[model samples]
Target: MSEVLEGVEKAEAEAVQIREKAQSQVEEIQRDAERKARGIEQIVRTQLTKEIEALQKSVESKAKNKSQRILLKADEEAVSLEEQGTKNIKKTVDIIIKGVYAFGGGGK
Candidate 1:
């Protein structure tokens, strides 16, 4: 009966030790999982930042190109209007001179 009691005590101690070890292992696993999750989060954030920057540059480049095309077209239109105005100058002047002579009751 004394030996049987000793055996039971030893078994209980061993079971306690096993439980402690398992608890320690679980804590370690949780810590490792948290560390890995932080690392993955950092990587995803970095990738997203890079993609956003690239997109901003692409949009800026496209806007610049569009603005350049519009400016060039406006400049061309201004030049065309200037040329037309120059071409009409002689006729405009002649008409003005004829009107002045008629208003003065003089021969042209």
Candidate 2:
């Protein structure tokens, strides 16, 4: 009977040790999972940042090109109007000269 009692105690002790070891393993696995999750989050954030920057650059380039085109068109229109004004001024001067000559009787 005493030998059976000792054996029971030994079995209980081994069971306690097994429980403690299993608890420790569970804690380690949780820590490893947390670390991996953090790493994955950081990788996703970096990728998003890079994509946003690239999109911003593309938008800026397109806007710049559009602005340049608008300015070139404005400049072309200004030149056309200036040429038309010059032609009108020459016609006005010729009309005035003819009227003056007729009124003055060709300077007598």
- As for candidate 1, its clashing pairs are none
lDDT of 2 at 7: 100
Candidate 2 lDDT by residue in tens digits, 1-108: 999999999999999999999999999999999999989988999999999999999999999999999999999999999999897998878888888888978731
Q: After superposition, how far is residue 22 of candidate 2 from its true place, in Å?
A: 1.1
Predicted candidate 1 versus true structure: per-residue lDDT over 1-108, tens digit per residue? 999999999999999999999999999999999999989988999999999999999999999999999999999999999999899999889888998999889745
Whole-model lDDT for model 1 versus the true structure?
0.96
Candidate 2 error regions (>4 Å): 39-41, 89-108
- Taking every candidate in turn, the Cα RMSD to the unseen true structure, in Å, is 4.4, 6.5
